[model samples]
Target: MTEAAAPRTPGSPCWVSLLVHGMGTTQDFYADLFGWEFVPGPDQLGPYVRALIGGKEVAGIGQLPPDRHLQVAWTTYLASDDVDLTAEAVRSCGGTVAVGPLDAGESGEAGRMAIAADPGGAVFGIWEAAAHLGTALAGAPGTPVWNELVTRETSTVCKFYQTVFGYEAEAEVSADFDYQTLRLDGRPVASLHGVGHALPRDRGPHWMTYFEVADTDEAARRVVELGGQVLHPPRDGASGRVATVADPEGAAFAIVRSTTAG
Candidate 1:
């Protein structure tokens, strides 16, 4: 694969998603983080959990079958009224279409999506909103307001997204990091990019969730107390401090308190 900067349609991101390992983890982790309340849906698709930050529904977590291999992780799901059309666009755009406009079951009707790499190895999900409009949470401390991509090839991924979601990448991202923003319907929705060499080998391609926190140090410590592991300590960044972590089952995610609103 040729290497180049994967530029995305410059703007802000739209929405993100939360993936989980098991049901209890899908419940317990965010409950401590966002003070979420449980809402029962059809007992079959399982319970739908809503996280409340400042007394408003900010994010959500739900259980999935073990085979999905998607433990508990946050994925920024961009809005889409037509997932099938988007999937087709993904194929025409030179990106690998991993999933579909297939049935995601009563999660309020979502067009399922998964894509890879930039200049072509980071994997993230695209949720074409149906009944669910996305996380109720905004830029509240301890809730998710932003989702960033850490990948290898940044440019190829940009083309894939532009073709898949009608997004564009920015030209500048500070020498410290590279970034590509996903835009849809002429509005910013999510982001794409390459950062660390952690992709391709350790975890394959995946979307990581970043939860808003007041203090990264304290939050990382709490993760340890709650059966989660602190994979990396809190580090300084333009977005304040962030710590890489995993749930009880070892599903990875991050916690951040940004300087600007996410």
Candidate 2:
């Protein structure tokens, strides 16, 4: 397992959590796939659970509110120094706050969090950590390796994130495809890509989280065996062998076997 550490920069993809049904089943699937262990969140946090890798926090899973009707999916949270200011920035840049500039815990042990969407309609979160500073492990088997914004509105989405997070375009992987790398402090932290003609049609703009796996083909195969669907067959990419998959409950995410392990 790679050493886990909290994100240090403002624009970093600090943490990710999934809101899904059948908490135990969802947890079991991921635990089997990624070797993650789940621990219940603080009592006041309500139905929240943390996913850990090698005793280090990696992700979170929580139950959906009984009254809400939303699809199950992973939501990435970007590190922020101030969630209120970031929420305002999201609004000023053409995004909407879907929920909270509220405390994540009774005494704010988790942090202040707010769910917001970019102009292109991708949902994400802003977190100002208090006792919890987000994911503690990365770049290892079952740990998050990358995050990408897969959207047709690449330009608009890119500009909105730039304004809100001080992100800069570092490289363009495909001019015709409108695929670009977004950098924070000159480091490639996430990617932005236009929807390809051959890619699956997403309902709208959204961020796709990628986790590292020991073997892409094996992981994809297990996803099917576990009753999840393989959306993209294992294939070579600029970074590594990759596959797109959806959990049984229909939350889609990607898995990668990095060309060069970090």
lDDT of 1 by residue, 1-262 (tens): 1111122222233344454656676577657754666654322334545565555545555666657764345555555555567556656665555655455545535324343323244455455544444455566676665666666756666666666555655645678666776655555555655765756466655666677777789888888888889888999976678889987867787888777644
- Candidate 2: list runs displaced more than 4 Å: 43-45, 171-175, 196-202
lDDT per residue (tens digit) for residues 1-262 in model 2: 4564554589889888899878889998999999999888843435989998878988999988777888688988999999999999999889999988988877787789899988877889899988888888878898888899888747777888899999998546565667878898789989888875644564567789999999999999999998899988999998999999999999999999999975
In model 2, pairs of residues that clash are 4-136, 5-136
Poorest 10 consecutive residues of model 2 by lDDT? 196-205
Compared with the true structure, model 2 gives a TM-score of 0.94
Full-model lDDT for every candidate: 0.59, 0.86
The C-alpha RMSD in Å for every predicted model, in order, reads 7.0, 1.7
Instruction: Kindly report which residue stretches of model 1 are placed more than 4 angstroms away from their true locations once superposed.
Output: 1-21, 42-48, 66-72, 96-100, 103-123, 173-177, 181-189
